[model samples]
Target: MARFFSRDRHGRRPLPSDGFDRALGIAHRWFLDRVGEVATIQYVTAPADMDWWRKDNTPPLISGGIGSSGQVALTLHRKFIELKYSDDGMLPERLYELLITEWAALTGKDVSEIDPEF
Candidate 1:
């Protein structure tokens, strides 16, 4: 990953500036911290053209907002975080817990309800 960002199109490795190095260091640390929770991670060249088919090539049936596959997917595009779980009703609750913890840390108030800005 370092080589991916460090090298130019001609495979020349330019000396990175202090800020760029620092940003890369932080990203590496963040990735390392969450690597254990991830099942798989892939760096794609064209995400839009990427195949999202299941192994059986059948679309999961949805019933009352939940799918028959019992999978919940969470994606944080800004952080490039994607987490998928095969369960019943645990994924959203887990996300809420994370949001509440982060919100409390950012703002010293304990929020009972949060209106998502996004």
Candidate 2:
């Protein structure tokens, strides 16, 4: 099992992607039957500049992966923010949004509701 954390708007604390995947799996399955079980979630946060010297003799970067266990993880570095959801991949964007909105409604919160800083 992976650790989970709920993050408030300001993005102050980082929320584990693994937890998010698990939550999404349960919620989407119950609400839309769209989100499938997560097999892996990898996050690669890297700069757009320098070459990948270490990997291919390029620049500095962050890259990582997860497998099995339905995990969600994030890698944060400097330039990019990459979120890769494994478990058979996400449903269509429209369906994804509908799921999110429905979840918000169920929680008595508007889909647009988020911390101003977030």
| Per-model lDDT | 0.34, 0.40
User: RMSD of each candidate?
Assistant: 14.0, 15.3
The whole-model C-alpha lDDT of candidate 1 against the native structure comes to: 0.34
Clash count for candidate 1 is: 0
Model 2 lDDT, residue 116, Cα: 22
Q: Return the TM-score for each candidate structure.
A: 0.23, 0.21
The ten-residue window of minimal lDDT in model 2 covers 73-82
